[model samples]
Target: METVINLFMEKLRNNKGVGLFYFSGHGVQHEGENYLIPVGASRVLRAADQLRYKAVAAGFVLASMKAAGNEVNLIILDACRNAPFKSGFKGDMIPPGLTTMPTVPGALIAYAASPGGVAMNGSGRNSPYVKHLIAWMEKPQLSLNDILRNVRRAVHKETNGIQSPGYYDELNEAFYFNQQVAVNDLAEQQRLAKEKEKLQRQQAELQAERDRLAGEKKAIKKEKARLQAEKERLARQRERDSTPITPTGSKKVFRDRLKDGSLGPEMIRIKGGSFRMGDIQGGGDSDEKPVHSVSVARFAMGRYEVTVGEFRQFVNATGYKTDAEKKGSCYTWVGGNSGKNWRNLGFSQTNTHPVVCVSWNDATAYAKWLSQQTGHTYRLPTEAQWEYAARAGTTTSRYWGNDPNDACRYANVHDNTSKQKNQGFSWTHHNCTDGYAQTAPVGRFKPNAFDLFDMLGNVWEWTCSKYEDNYNGEENRCAGRKSGSLWALRGGAWYYLPGFVRAASRGRNSHDDRNYYVGLRLARLL
Candidate 1:
């Protein structure tokens, strides 16, 4: 089964057009994870782990499709018949029916029965779900969504609500099973015209709502500015009340003045410290091996990931184009989408959201521009410094703790909210919801022990150190930004799974690679 999936994935990678995968067999759920059972698999069901090893993991199939990066992919599973291992499995160890899986970008997965519900093996030749699916699929010009909706309705009626078809869709564009249009039919043409007119009306309504939201956003920004001014005034007053001190004894939080006299990003003072670097916790990757002690000098680091508003100010002042803008695209879940940059992400973003789609070079340039504006030494943190700050005196997988379930309180990661919004794509997400599907406003969640926001998730932060397979002296110092060097990226992004959101997890990309999942934070010599 794995070999078959691999071959299908390879074919999908080679094909630029649409791809479709359909399976008809027995499927089961083990501990909330779905699996498809191949023929003669009942012999290997002595243990739960054995079944896991033998059965085809539905997640692996979904992930392979995502990795293939096809434009449109469809998966139909008529495998929700009664469990094949009911005699061998005990209790809920092997559930009665298959579990639901998320859809990847530009893909959809349809099931013969609603998630966690059983389906009849069919008294007739075909199950009710498959029968309706076939009937609806043959209809011309019916979209996949429409066909599935019809199938669900028909199956519910046929089974008297005992079974209903289900689907997870993450497609950005409509896909029709039959592309033929009834152009000669006058009634069909009039119906199409009316549909187009209705779509235009909806678009107009959306534009009006967007305009209203824009006005509200402007008002909120003004209010936020007023509040920030008040906070700054209080901070200044407190500074004046205390004795002036050197960088080594500076206050916990401080901000520098920009060239326009506006305050820059809030900086948190990190005291000099020595600690073990690399994956202290077990289950980390090989790159995070060889844990060694490293000492960092006293410095100030950004309290939050750099915001869209902050990056915009630099762009406005310098008229600097980001690497994404220059390259004409940024990598997204769907692949490199043309014209998708920081200013024009496919989704909506407020000014407070952390700026993404900026490459390592762009990040470094922003740091340089900031240093010029503030007359302070600003740069990306060394790999060790970032890990140290992120760890914040913790030895756990994350500063919050080992359990990924508690992630919603500490950081914005792939969670229940994301699963609900991006119903396409399968991943093990945090058990909780952080009230955001994508990037949340910086500092929305609770900060770590070091009072740093989004150190683990929101967007991957670039470091000044080059990536190496194993720990060397490079982790402690900045590597020269020579071409073809792979710079290290710390933290994770909104779309990251539980394993990738750990403090010790490391990622690397070329300096010029711009992605929607990457951003930056700056550190300064205090």
Candidate 2:
């Protein structure tokens, strides 16, 4: 796989556009860190073997789709299948499934389930996930994320709560398998295609006219050249002599950080589904243990994390202030003198900036407001859901790797000195960087393989689970159970080191405990 990824590097060139890759298989998490098991597994997969296996890290996915380089690169992972062999992996039952070539911009990646969650075994000859995914690939209506949502729900019902699906992506341009080819109406697409053909014919006629006039006497030639040019010019009209232009709003909108680095608005589709859910590892928390199945019906979920613009829409509609804005708190260096208040951050932020410094209440408020605005259910991703997405289709510890240094690329964490000092990793300041000084704009960095952003670090996102002390009483929690409901938070923030960002890193706080580093992203059923 390492050699294959390297080969992709050779083919990838600036200006060529996007790239994409998809993968599926076993993922392991320990002490809150995640790791994707590779093809040649050792008796037990460990942090050390990861370096040897050369497993794909989340950072590698980001660097490959560098927005500045080849347009955009996207990746999809269908991992998250429940597999045997956890603590000391010794397995015949476990199998590393499929993976694909790396993809660049003008690409799309889709996942079978959320990261860290398992996919259901197909009840039919083909697994439910596989059958539905195959169907999605054959059609053109569903965008990458849209079809996966269908597959996600199908497998959930097929397994009855044994697994959930997820994915990640970083695309510079939109590349749907089949977007409304020229807007939905068949007449519209045909009209556009005809217009393009007419322009080509006219351009050819004008070229011929110029050629015909070029042989005339010198003075006549000059005079005739002007005439011919005018005639040729009209011949290339793209609008078609009888057509009217489509209204501005009627045109399909496209958003991207294109070859020239432009940003624009893009429409999003919501996906929803039901699935079986639970951990294969024996240590599943009470809520995750016993691994019964669930039947999450279909619903919509955003394809990517909510942008600052999207969140602002909610704030504008509700006139609601997040906990941080209300409390006048700012993100502070864990030990910095400025850690006193939000005003200390020293900058006026905008609506397009991700709303940071939130508590669970703030996150939930935003979700509620969004639900009201869009008339759909919206809320923080559950712990299982968040992991499934964060993993995209991977199960690697930390998404990227065990190395803390590599995290700087995908997340704004303590890898650099100033950030480390602020969020608390002061001891390793040798290679620290205070680059942005504050949060860079959302999506400023690259995305994970699934096209999801900030899954590893940036802000610690709130989840829908209550934190528990241990995984000791597992069985009771798995059977349609409800334990502590204070809600747990997953994914590390800029305040912590990369190690803490590992999927296994867990934290608990009251619903009202707001901080400069807390924020939220939402998910829904399909």
Candidate 3:
């Protein structure tokens, strides 16, 4: 058997074609090595020394084939029969079946049964594995992998999961046993040539469209830069001509009276000024790039984020339902769970805590209702106005400074307290501890430079600007309610990391999507 296999391997040397070798005889494994039994062997040839001289090593066969350097090679072994030397071999000295063989490039080795499994010889002339393999190979247009997979499934099902065929394949190119050819070869070649030409033409058209879009994007960016420059110039002229209102003292604070004689949210006057928007301190996302100067007009912004009590007032007066309440769901830390809403967030929140689980649409509706009740133009702040007020004349990463360790004193970010309470929380947190684990009271932490409470933490505040990849004119103006666009969310939530709690960091969501970390702050034009 060894001499015959060597002679066969010489025929395949440097052939540059597909080669196949199949064996259907007894095989055995000794000391983790596979050997094939030859015909007319001695019945008592069970010792390792005697078998080494008569039996053919399977490794030698594979190594010789690899040296042949064929383009593709396949080896099939249906030799995992019951052990014939049970009397001579010790108990469990040799395993039931063959060991796994190492695979080489451009080769596939198939076994009739899985490693350490015994193959069953059917009552017919051949085994069940060989029967399925022959049947599948005769079918045209079936790749080699597909044929083997079908054989494995059929044999496993037929034997009730007792026997399973397996293969180790490293074939670089697709291979089919019986490939089909077109009847009219010349006509088929002409049709394929036409199809290729059409495909090339379509690709050319796509490239042209992409180029046109690129040009339009460049032009839009240029127009945005021109408008921003004009805005800054106009703002400087207005500042020189008119007296600026001092943003300090109690005179800048005011509250509107509702029809029921109740005072509305406390509003702080933000003095008009020009500031460079977007990530200035580095280590930010691409969406915060291409920072530009934006001049904000004087506006009154809420001193604190809208609390649950304030939102409840609006809902009671108008009998309104929030988006989360209407949809009967809200996205939380564990994901969107049914029966979770602003009222029942699976965590305790007092009336003083910031209102969460509110969508952009819900925030806008609340603002409109507040305006009707107080007779004032109240809405969500623009992205530019929110960043400018949050920064308050400083250019550091955070309003307090670049040090994140100082976060616990000024903001309720993810801290040691929350991490200790929730064992599953594995995110990076501030080393210091904030007293509360969940949403802290609106004014529990220190305020920013503008005297705004919870400007960078507790809960993210909704803005009226439509989200864009870069700073366009939309960041400076409020987006219309009817536009189907994602609204921006500024600040960071209590569960957010320190990197996201910066003035330049931005988050966005769809108009109707509600999240537990999002809330709102009112802004009024003066």
Local distance difference test, each candidate: 0.81, 0.51, 0.81
Q: What TM-score against the true fold does each predicted structure earn? A: 0.58, 0.41, 0.54
Among all candidates shown, the one with the greatest TM-score: 1
Off by over 4 Å in 1: 1-133, 136-250, 334-336
lDDT of candidate 1 at residue 115, scale 0 to 100: 78
Residue 45, candidate 3: alpha-carbon lDDT = 58
Which candidate do you rate higher for TM-score, 1 or 3? 1
Candidate 2 Cα outliers beyond 4 Å, as residue runs: 1-309, 325-331, 334-348, 417-425, 429-434, 471-485
Name the candidate that leads on lDDT: 1
- Candidate 3 TM-score, C-alpha based: 0.54
Tens-place lDDT per residue, model 1, 309-420, is: 9999999999999888898988654322688899988888889999999999899999999999999999999999999999999989999899997787678888867866
For model 3, what is the C-alpha lDDT against the true structure?
0.81
State which candidate, 1 or 3, has the greater lDDT: 1
RMSD of each: 16.4, 27.6, 28.1
Please tell me which model should have the higher lDDT, number 1 or number 2: 1
Candidate 3 minimal-lDDT segment of 10 residues = 85-94
